[model samples]
Target: MQDQPLDASDFELIEDTLLKYGDDHSVLNASELDGYFTALVSSPVQVDIAEWFPAIWGGQNPDWQSPDEGKQFIELSVRHINALATQLAMHAQAFKPRFEQTEHHAQPLTLAEEWCFGYLRGVAVGNWPELPTPLAAQLQAIAFCAEQDNFEPPADLDVAQHRQQIEAIEAAAHALHDHWVAQR
Candidate 1:
């Protein structure tokens, strides 16, 4: 499948399967899974699939109805993971985080809460070492976006600035990846 590009249908299938079979602790959807894979690919040290795959299902394997179903999920996830690594390595400028928009206080808000949350989860699984202050600051943008309960405008900032923070997640991801690449 290396020659074949993953399409929207592949993501839809992954999201549908996760929703259908995943427990409450599973990553919420395809966007989040993409974020998770991004973090894994960008890690300074490699994380084994055996160590990280179970975390995708909330620390256990999903109760897939059939072995074929389980195999398909694995295949799709691996393909996506490889795609993320290749993109980060060779086409960083074109990288985009899969964010979603929703109505917040009757205004359209682009949110990356789920995606950032999944990324943090991957960071935890990767057991990333403490970063220097500058790099840590880049990661702070992602952490800020991941706050589910406090997704509102920061008390110190206006709506536009808050939206900008959300928008900065993609740049933050690229910076983080580049930092790790430089370290390697």
Candidate 2:
């Protein structure tokens, strides 16, 4: 299969549709959606898409007025996720973690936080073993991103510092992917 990333518009459409149909309690925003997909594909255990879809989508197929569009969304998502898995597997160090860009009034930190939440969910589903010490420390850093909103940023953490944290999280993701692949 071709490994091209999904078009930005297509990604937005799928994310928007899922959000419209998802449970109110759902935390799987657009960035999380990608993270969840990556986790499913990288999972050591085989995951059945049929079962996984509903679970990820708040336990129901999206209530699309146009079934064809819903089907298209699924197809596109599967393809995009497959491409991600391919990249992670074949070129892990080169894998660039995808995150939602800050837009409108949204903060860049929010994107990182949401992406980390989704990524952690994915890692949970994969049932990864306890990571080695250095990797675990990196994972802890990523986990901290999930709590960004709850805690005030340190006075020393300026824009560049925040960006560094995000970059570290991305690097951590690559390391996590490598750890999983090595286990297989």
Candidate 3:
């Protein structure tokens, strides 16, 4: 599948879709954004990761067989997703509309980018029983940013590389968000 060339139409369609999913707010906050993600990802699809048994992969998902193991594994997954979303939402394409439409200096994120990130973060916070609405939303937003930048799921992703990419996006977003926040 990888060896096959990407069709132009397929690529273009995904790219267009990514453009539509950027932040609704010109200047978004983490908590609020996390809430947004939680709302989106709190559906049944997210609840049934690997058929509600993430350990199905020969215990590849952190050996989470026991109740406590499952709980911890889920929590860690959620946190990582939130981080990915945050990175996804921070790209230049996501903030382009904001920059052009408003006075903010932020960049733009495309539809596919926003969708991927939002989806990740949304899924992340959706499973957290203890996650406050605000904190969950913020984390979700962070996840959104990360996902947009090509975040892969744990079982399917390259952990070390993905983490580095997510971290870099987060650092850049933090700087940009801080600057805009200070203006208010």
Top TM-score model: 1
lDDT over C-alpha atoms for residue 142 of model 1 = 89
Name the regions of candidate 1 deviating beyond 4 angstroms: 3-5, 104-108, 149-159
Best candidate, lDDT: 1
Q: List the residue pairs that clash in candidate 2.
A: none
Candidate 1 displacement at residue 171 in angstroms: 1.0
lDDT value, residue 176 of candidate 1: 89
What does candidate 1 score on TM?
0.89
Error of 2 at 92 (Å): 3.8
Give candidates' CA RMSD values in order. 2.6, 3.3, 17.2
Candidate 2 — what's its lDDT? 0.71
lDDT by residue (33-128, candidate 3, tens digit) is 332333333332344455322322222334323676456434543553344334343442332111101111242212223333433444443443
The true-versus-predicted C-alpha distance at residue 109 of model 2, in Å, is 7.1
Better of 1 and 3 by TM-score: 1
lDDT of 2 by residue, 6-106 (tens): 78787788778777777754544677777777667666665677766776665666677898888877787788777888888886665666776653224
Model 1 scores a C-alpha lDDT of 0.83
Q: Candidates' TM-scores?
A: 0.89, 0.81, 0.22
Instruction: Report lDDT (Cα) of residue 131, candidate 1.
Output: 89
Instruction: Candidate 3: count the clashes.
Output: 45
